[model samples]
Target: MTGTAGSSRSILEGRGERSGRRSGGTRTLLIGLVADPGFATEIAHRLAEELPGALAERSGYRLHCRVTVVSETLSRGEGERIIDLAAQRRAREGWDFVVCLTDLPLSANQGYLVGDLSRRANAAVVSVPALDMLRPAEQARDIVVRLILEWAGELPADSGDQEIEGGGVGVRSGVQPVAPTDEDIDVEYAAPAGRLRLLVGMVRVNRPWRLVWGLRNAVAAGLASAAFGLVSSVVWQLSGAMSALRLGIATVASLAMIVLWLILNHNLWQHADRRDRVEYRQVRLYNAATMLTLVIGCGVAYVVLLAGSLATGWFVVVPQVLSAVIGHPAHVSDYLRLAWLVSSIGTIGGALGSGLESEDSVRTATYGSRERHRPPREPQHT
Candidate 1:
């Protein structure tokens, strides 16, 4: 109970330091993680971060475990290939367990698979994309733990220690442990979803940054910037017309439009159940996050526009051009007006950027949705 799961912070650094001191005497387990680059790296880091804490609780020998990514992704039907490669490399570069993670959706027998392990090969592959949960990293961690346990024969094959909702199947082995009472069985098998929720709760205990960058928020922001640029000119003119109040109005107007666009099209609250629709409080939270993201994106766009305008103004503001355009040397007010004008337009472009991005991209970029509640699957042969 003392080593119970709670925090998901990166224990690698601290644990590595401690483990290094004991390496001379302690046995070491090297885990190879092959993952697709982008989001898979996040999962790998999360796994590394949580592994020490999660494993500390399990009864085991005092061994040092080091997790390394294979620097490549494996596609469907590539698990065995990776395993073979790992085996080949094992002679020179040894690994105790090799787990491959891919962002690609994977299925077996037309059923989804979050991950699968083969004890004979001491290798495993996890489909990060197929994992549906608010905190997928923790689920991935749990699967890895079970796989390790099963491989070590720490738990019986029929222990039913691991479970996933939707269509994922758990690894099984021939080893058997003592039978549990009917009540214990019920408690074990009946708690799949509950355990998953608890794991997520544990993973997210103090992590708030996940919400900001969970989905490809960076890509969304880029798309927003692009979209804002498209209609930026028109918005700039309208703002210019309000010359006296242009600066204040332009900033507010642009930020508002970008936030509105995200809320409407980002599917931030598209719950599967009508009753599960976000409440007013949740709505406020989502809006606040959206506002923050949009403001940052829009601000970047504004700065770029301002810089470009300043460069253009500097390069083209000869005496003749100034005489023709303003009948005076371009002043600070002129530059300020130009900056305000372009920022207003960029705001609209940011909205356009959101629309330009595919729905899937947007979905991949946001983390406020609860789609991870999708039914889990029973595991099948890959």
Candidate 2:
């Protein structure tokens, strides 16, 4: 009877310990999603919906996602150090881990960084430009999840650390794993960032389509140029005489001219820190993004002009008049040729019209939020 009573007391003690654990609940890991304004913000907002659930499923931990959906440009003397910016926020917020999403190009020493991970601080920076533009949010989710899992010791020890020629086994190819270069960083993915991919991403982040409205003056001037060409017999003859190849070249040249005019007129290029390789690459990246934004803006202008010219030509220009100039009956091809030629001519007017736009207008249209926050690039006084 004494033995039976002792066993009953032990069961009560076991029940009490289990109840105590139930009251405590599972430990919650805090994950911060800090993004630069624009696409990065969009990605963060998107991930916030699924990240907690996804991380919990993948890492077997309860997760609380904290999203900062604006520009977190940490000011430093050398300007924004992406890694430091992320690490500081992680420490300040007391988050178990942080993942910074940014469209700004991240340079690592001499090479470009695809991912910058500081295991010690439990923070990482994912350069959105380095990921494939198609479905970047999904790619970012995968990367962020893996990094968190690796840091939490949930992933296998050998799974994510080995460096391969193009990439680590599970990570994206052409983005090789990196050993820590910075004192604060523990793991990194530094590769020759695909220049075209980076440029495209930068253009996407700049949201050049916004320029369509921003350059109202440019559009107005282009429409005026197209209107004049439609009424002119000389323009009709010239457009008809031009071959398809010539029309394509003219389109490219005119677009280039407008892009150049905007860059030179507004002083949009980043001029500082060209002597150091890292600074040179960064400046080059920003300049390239600037050029691309203008090119895309011009490209949109050209399309608008082309469409307007075609519509105007159809309604205003008599078919018989165009046939008389080219010494052949006007066909659909003739109309296209005329529209193409007129659009090229119109884009030049856009170049001139762009001059009327304020520097702030051009600057805002051409740069991402990070660059927008920066003072305009100035000339070296030396």
Candidate 3:
């Protein structure tokens, strides 16, 4: 299989080179427009119409650029899939360069996505703020054309020589430079670092809450398991022959409930990215801490219940750590008490942890200290 894969790759590379040569030296430019779906489509449409004409006039190159608009909301895997498709097409047909344009600021994950794709696909990546899309069509056209020219090695290296005509009469030339907005840039660059800090802070602030929540989940799961076990034991007592069937049904139901709980929890955590940008490692640590706290809470609750049972002289309903070994059955009430106590503690701890994580994320997301606006020094104190 590996040999076949290697041979296929060799064939593809050879074909890709041949395709590049067959295009009559008219390099195929793959322009990837990633942004808000609605905005990206609009910008792409304008580019499709205006670019060829603008480039033909400005650079004197009949540039055949193909613009492919990809919405940035796609998952990282999905984005890679799209890039793979583009590369395959390029290799078969022919492409000179791939340029990616995004309406997101460079400081955002979306901005990072563009950079990632640029490096992976060996394409030029450009980021433009969404607000800039509101500029006049001609103005937008100019920026796009200029960017394309720059990528194609047609634009002058220095900024001084570049001029845009018809500025005042609504043909806004060079209105908004082709650069990411300050806000977008700030978020893109600051978010990951900020998120990490936020996660750490949350761990500190919400440790108690997380401990509580973990206890709660653990107790709930344990009670459910114990109940199923008790019910199975009762079935065995009532009907010796049919006990196995009854026990099987109870086991299946318990398993189903556990599976459902797990699925719901997984979904909630998966979609919580917008809330805290929580990654897998952070979530794993949180779950571990929570479960440990739950166990501790349950142990404490068991001791309390045992003390109460002993003082009340309720010998009929005794809390036993191991029913079979002690020859004393565990009471349902004791299990209920433990479950509720543990769950409450776990919930509290989880909430606290999540909040702290969010705050830490925000703090860390902010880039290097804002430039302090210092008052100019008074002329020499002579």
Q: lDDT: which candidate is best?
A: 2
Q: lDDT tens string, model 1, 298-339?
A: 455456655655565445444344434444555666555655
**Candidate 2: which pairs clash?**
none
Query: Candidate 3: lDDT of 15?
Result: 41
RMSD of each: 13.3, 9.2, 20.4
lDDT of 3: 0.37
Error of 1 at 352 (Å): 3.8
Q: Taking the tens digit of each residue's C-alpha lDDT, what string does model 3 give over 1-382?
A: 2443344234324545432332444544445554333344565667667676666677655455566555433223321333343344444434544444443333333212212222224343333332222343454465556545544445444542335542301123213322334321211111122333333322332223333233344434443433333333342223223334553454344334433343344222221244564344445444443333323433453344334323332333234433543244645543443333333333333333333332222221111100011122233355
lDDT for each residue of candidate 2 in 228-267, tens digit (9 for 90 to 100): 9888889998998888899999999989888888778777
Scored by CA lDDT, what does every candidate get?
Answer: 0.48, 0.71, 0.37
Q: Order of candidates by lDDT, top first?
A: 2, 1, 3
- Give the range of the ten consecutive residues with the poorest summed lDDT in model 1: 1-10
Off by over 4 Å in 2: 1-25, 61-68, 71-76, 87-96, 119-122, 161-172, 192-194, 272-274, 324-327, 364-382
